[model samples]
Target: MEEQRPCLNKAEKGCEGPVEGRPSYAGTGTLIWRCTAHDNKAYEAAQETRTRYPDSSTPPGWFDPAAAGERWDDEY
Candidate 1:
């Protein structure tokens, strides 16, 4: 049987879904896995945070603001 990985956002979002998208990297370069729902949510959140705090550090488990031009598909 294929291994099933739980969503990384389970604690924050109370999600019970398996990871459904490619893995992504956090600003700290940590690998993250999420379900499709949380993946989109995180991407949107990162964009908003980058817009609001252009000179500040990105939140944990988010992509670096400097890498805004990078796509998730290109990472893995």
Candidate 2:
């Protein structure tokens, strides 16, 4: 049997659900594994943050640097 990956959302909000599907990558290239419930919450929060602070220097985890005309270099 495949080992279940705990949802990363637990760190943020005490979610006890296991990861159900493919993981997502954060703007900083961090792997985020979340259950369906937390995943939706994170996505919505990220969207709201982006909409409210379009020019903010720090992008949310769900933000893709490449898609926003920003380059991500590992050497940095």
Candidate 3:
């Protein structure tokens, strides 16, 4: 059987109250699964990074903040 990930976020078992690494302030409020075999902590980290550093789809990479596209404020 395939087991869930072992991430130390709010989704962790027996984890009540505000979790340290879990996204608490604002987000879609998705529930993360807890597992002992593996840890899917990357999801939370990526989410946090995305929230902290929002990318603009103005150009090539779409991750550039000062990218200029067809219009000045062509951000996606």
- What TM-score, computed on C-alpha atoms, does each candidate reach? 0.52, 0.53, 0.24
Q: Is candidate 1 or candidate 3 better by lDDT?
A: 1
Candidate 3 colliding pairs: 5-35, 6-38
lDDT of 1 by residue, 1-76 (tens): 8767777666666564567645443354545667766777777876776676676543445654433323433433
Candidate 2 lDDT tens digits, 1-76: 9877777556565564557644332255555667777777766755676578766665456766433223333333
Report the C-alpha displacement of residue 12, candidate 3, in angstroms: 18
RMSD of each: 7.6, 7.3, 12.1
Ranking of predictions according to lDDT: 1, 2, 3
Where's the lowest-lDDT run of ten residues in candidate 3?
63-72
- Candidate 3 residues lying further than 4 Å off, grouped into runs, are 1-39, 56-76
Q: Show the colliding residue pairs in model 2.
A: none
Runs in model 2 with CA error above 4 Å? Answer: 1-3, 11-26, 58-76
Q: TM-score order of candidates, best first?
A: 2, 1, 3
Best by TM-score: 2
Model 2 earns a TM-score of 0.53
